[model samples]
Each structure stands twice: as C-alpha cells, then as structure tokens.
Target: MIEPDSSGDRPSGSAPETTGRFIVVFAETEADPPAFLRSAAGLSNVADSRDFGHGPVDPATAGDADATVFASLGVAVVTADPQQAGALRMSSDQSNIESISPELVHHALSQGTLSPPSALFQDTEHFTWGLQATGAATSPRTGKGIRLAVLDTGFDSSHSDFAGRQVTVESFIPGEDPQDGHGHGTHCIGTSCGPRSSREGPGYGVASEADIYAGKVLSNSGSGSDGGIIAGIEWALVNGCAVISMSLGADIAQVHPPYTAIGRRVLDQGSLIIAAAGNNADRRQNDFGFVGAPANSPFILAVGALDEQLDLAYFSARTLPVRGGQVDIAGPGYRVHSSWLMPDRYNTISGTSMATPHVAGIAALWAEATGYRGRELWSVLVQESSRLQAPSVDVGSGLAMAPQE
Candidate 1:
C-alpha cells in the first residue's frame, strides 16, 4: 500500500484536513501531474493518481509508480469541485452534446457539464415526502432543515425548486462535473428532498426544506467503483452530513474489500446510511427473497423495492444472509417518479435504487424532528416501518411507509 509522505508536515489534528489539490485522470492528458494541478488552480500538492488502464499508462515508470501518489499527498482525500468534475456523457449521449453558451459554462463545464436542455434530462415527478397532510401523520417534526448528503449522480441545480438551496458538488470520475448525465441520481434526490416543482402531484417534494450535499460518486451511466464510493462516503462523513442516501449497491460476494472498511467508518462516525438492496432479482431464486450486499452491512439500512401496485419488483434481488443477519427494510421502488436529465422533464425508473431514497427522505424528516444522530435516525425509521406479514425473504419490512410521510 502506498504510505502517506513522511516528508510533508500535515496540520496536527485528529482528522485529516482536505487540501485544495485534486487529481484528474483520463485517457487523454500527456502533461505532468504537477503542472496540470498547478494550472487548474493554486494547489499545494498534486501527484499522478490512479491509472484506470484506459488512460495513458507510461510503461517506463519505476517501482511503486502510480499507486504511491495517493498515500503520499495525504491530499489523496481532496474533493472535486463543480469546476473540477465537468460531466462525461456516453458517446451517443455525446453526439448532440456541445459546449453551452453564456460564459457560465466555463465554470459549470470545467468540473461537470449539464446536458443542454434538449440533451436528455427531462425533469420528472417531485420526490419529497414531508407534505403536512399527505401520507404520514401531521407531526411537527418531519425534517424541515436537516442536511443530507446525496452520493449518487449530481443534482439539477438548474431546477427551480432547488433555488436558494446550498449545494456543494464533487466528482470521482475525472472530467465529470456535477451536472447529472443520467437521470437516476436526479430521481434519487427528488425522492429524498426535492421541493415542489410542478402540479398534478408531480411538484410536491419530500423533506423539501432540508439542505442537500451533492456527492457525485457514480458516473452519469449510473455506475461507480467501490473505491470511489468509499472516498465519497468519507467526504460526506466529515462534511457535516447527518444522513446519507446511497441509492446503489453491489452483491455481497462481488464488492471490493475497501467497501467493508469504508462502510463501517461512515456508520461509526455517526452518519445514517441508506443503500439499495440491488435490482438483480434472481430469475432462478424463488419469490420472497431479495437481499443484497454492502447493503447487507449490518449498520446500513438495506432497502428492498416494491412497485407502484405496492407489489415487490420481480427483478428485485431475493433477500439472503437473512438468518445470518442481513437485509433490513423495503419501500416503493417500481415506476417511482423523480428528476431527469432534461431541465423540464421527470420520470420514474424502476429498481431497489428507487426504494432506497424513500427511506432516506424519511430519515430527513426524523432528523428535523428528533435531531437524531445517524444511528438514531435509522432506528426511528426502522421502528416505524410496516413489515410484510409473513416475515418473508423478499420483502424485509413488508412495506416501509414512514410515520410522518
């Protein structure tokens, strides 16, 4: 493992302070890392970060070449700003994509770029749940102002409802800015704390007033590595986030090792984590079984998915590690409506990914009321969940309708 540079003196604090320096990796760029980082902005440290193989891999390097960068800089922990992440769209999704005008694109694109209104993101249904007289009881505490860290694709800062809200965007994929390329992240956030957008029951949001932290760990394609996720979780844990909505997952046996340590760290640091049980409902496994992992992390509240009809999705993974202490809750997942890539459209995409946010949105309400710590927030939510009558494997808690809606 690459070690932290013993040569540099870091400020002596229990926590590692984030340095302004950030590394950018891509198939392009032949310039030296030191020059690139210094040119991007005034950074104190920089190094040749990871080589994803797709990039220019200089074969002539010495021993301990690329991997040593992060362990040394200590700045390995640095974050990607909006100006740094600029979004990367899929090729077909790129043909029509072009540099936007108004000069603002300079700032928005350098880190992450939004699709031109006609590109692809069509805003869909609003995903908030804290309407006073809606699904849950009209309680005084339903997450009015707590902050939640959304670690997925970035959000639609251009959306009107998000107006006046404070958002800090970061990226893991180089050249990927905060502008969400895939509508998945937008939908996920809309479910958690989106504000009133349109009428027809599409404008009202859940936990509408809470602050949001945009941690873009997944790419616009709705995929990310366990390493990137771990790093993103670290950012959320130390950045004043009370609740974290991670609407994605990998199988119990498929995930990388770093995931175990990072998942545990996020929880130990007092952050409530909500993750999807995965959409891989086995074609072979009998019905009533939908447990998946990392989501199965005991400290994490693993959420299962149910369709619009209130029935579980066929593709939703069957719950396992059940007797072994895995799986936790279930929520509405199929055809759920939320934000999209287009500036004006919104749509409901199916998956346990959709279900995970409902729990997160609900956690926001709990935090607003009890000021519950991460663990406490999750505890209250689980205690109030509506479970399946038979205690089957597919639907963990049967149904997860928050008390406060």
Candidate 2:
C-alpha cells in the first residue's frame, strides 16, 4: 500500500518499502567477512568482493550465493531465512557485527511532472535559470579533473550532447542494463556533467569536464533495493569518484541504519555522497514533510529544492528534528531544464531530485578548485553557500554556490 504525501497525490510518509533480504554491517576493522559470516552465521555460499577486483557487482551474477560481501564498506546483503536472519541479528558475538537491517526500496525523488513557477531568473541563449541562479554559469571552474558519480535509474549514453565525454556506466540492478529507461538519471547527469557548449538550448550542466560514472542502482520503474544502491556506492568508491550524487531515496523519516555506517565509511575514503532531501512537502496545504532515509544519514549531505526566486520549492522537504535529517544546502530545482532521453533529448522537471545534482556538480567544481575531499569538501560547500532569510530547517546554509575562481 502506498502512503500518500501531504498533497494526497504522491507517495510519502509511509513505512519504508523493504525487500525481505537482510543487510549485515560488519565492524570496520573486520579482516575477512567471508570467514566471519561462515563461522558466526554458519553459512558458506558467500561471494567475496575481493574476488571481483573492485568493480560494481551485479546481484544476478551472485547466482546461488547466500550472501554477498562488499569488502570496502564492510557490509553484506544476505538472503537468509527467518531463523538464519534472527541468528545474525541476535547473536551474542557482537565483536565483528555492527547492525542488521532489512534492505529498503528507494525511488527516484522526482515529482513526475512539471509545475510552472513564477518567473525570476529566466533561461537565456547561454544558460538555464538554474545555472544563472546558482552562479554556475559564470564560475571559472569546469571540474576538469574531478570524477563524479550519479547513482540513479541510469544514463542515456545516446544523448547527443555527451558525444565525446568520458563516461563509465554500470548497472547494479539485476536483469537491467545501464542505459536509462527512466529519464531521471539522464536529467541529473545533464545537470551535473552535460556539455558547456550545446547545439540544443542554453548550457544546463554545472561541471562540464568531470568524468561521469553513471551507476544504475534503481530499476527502470524508478524503484531500487538497498543492496543495489550500496553496490553503486562501492563502485563509486573503487573508481575514486570525488563526489556521488544520489537523486533517489526512501520516504521514511527515521535515519536508515546501513547508510549511517556506509556514509561515514565512504567519507573517510575521501568521497562524499549528496542526496535529495526528498519531494514530500506541500507548503500550500501547510504540510512541510520531513527529510527521508539515506539523505537523513548524518554523514551524507542532504539538499533541499529552491526556485529561481531562491525560495524553497513547495515540494521540497523540511528538515526533520533529527541529527542528520536537516537540509544541509539548497539548489535551483523548480522547473529546471536539463538533459533527458533521446528523441525528447531535453526536459524541464521539478523536485529535490533536480536540485541534488546541481549541488553535486558544484561540489565537483569545488573539488577541482580547492582540492578538497570528504569532510573538507562537505565543509567548503556549507561554508561557502549563500545564506537565505528562510529558517535553516527549510534551506539550511542557503543556496549552494559555484566557486568564482
């Protein structure tokens, strides 16, 4: 059953969707997860990631393996019976174990349609309103040396604007290719890494020269399980992406357990994950929705949506009264123009989904200009953002800005 958002239209504020499989987070110092799982949980059909040599793991490739261990993040996604799962959860051997959780189902954070906003910063012959509003249009940095990861529904490799760019594509979803079936990933990729000079309209991308790592974590239908998303993160880390942009999330207010550890671990490795704060609000109806899982993890940066006028988007979620649930930054998301799938080629959409990649692209620019990574990169974004008059719960440190020099 899909729970309705404040607008009584979109799904939000429900118990998070979950897959029956369990996620096991091992202690960071655990040396051999394959042996630990065998001795503690008494199962042996495990696929160790060290065998795959640090690339994205396709779940289908695991075949009959009962558990798949991501060695870098020290986590495993296990297909266990209730007895087996309960044993791992309730085990007295707590030395090597951290947390066990049901894998969650996440969706693309788009509103699925466009809503006309009162015009403020209009698109010009050279730039989209988002690029103009965030100062990305005039910023000198092109993120030339940075590597950015966009983990979502996938990317459109056939898009004309990206003809000569370097892009690495991988799919973590079983039975799906990395080619984008849903337009969300393509749109996000355009916002973050599309070309600076385009035959289409104005330039909509932020970090034009950054290497693109498109990881298809969500299925074509716009939903994904935690295992696939985690796999994407591992892939991004292994590939040395300086920033990871996640425009997908579960609409649960509570912080998800796995991401707390995963987020912290990824940052320590010098990569930052930036996620949409969520599109569950309806301010016209006076319901300011809370930030959702993955985004709500303290170690990950949460971004809310703002319009060309620099006010919070009506659908952009408000900060939940939790440590990591607060919106850390804002970006132009309402009716933002960016790349889409072929034939259509371009789209104008609204959501925190659109806002996330703007900050991500800007993050790449900062990564290039300042040579900052992980926590330092996160700090630079917060410290350099333009402060707005709205409450911090709605806009955080205000809008994310591009580096001028």
Q: Rate the local accuracy (lDDT) of all candidates.
A: 0.60, 0.90
TM-score of each: 0.62, 0.71
Highest TM-score model number: 2
lDDT of 1 by residue, 98-134 (tens): 2111111112336546442221112234423222212
Clashing pairs in model 2? none
| TM-score, structure 2 vs. true | 0.71
User: The CA-based lDDT of model 2 is what?
Assistant: 0.90
* Model 2 Cα lDDT, one tens digit per residue, 1-405: 111221112235865666666678887778898898887778779998888876778667775798999988898988877567656765525667777766777788987465544448888889999898888999999999899999999999999899889999999999999999999999999999997667879999999999999999999999998999999999999999999999988899899999999999999999999999999999999999999999999999999999878888999999989889999999999998899999999999999999999999999999999999999999999999988867899999999999999
Q: Judged by lDDT, which candidate is best? A: 2
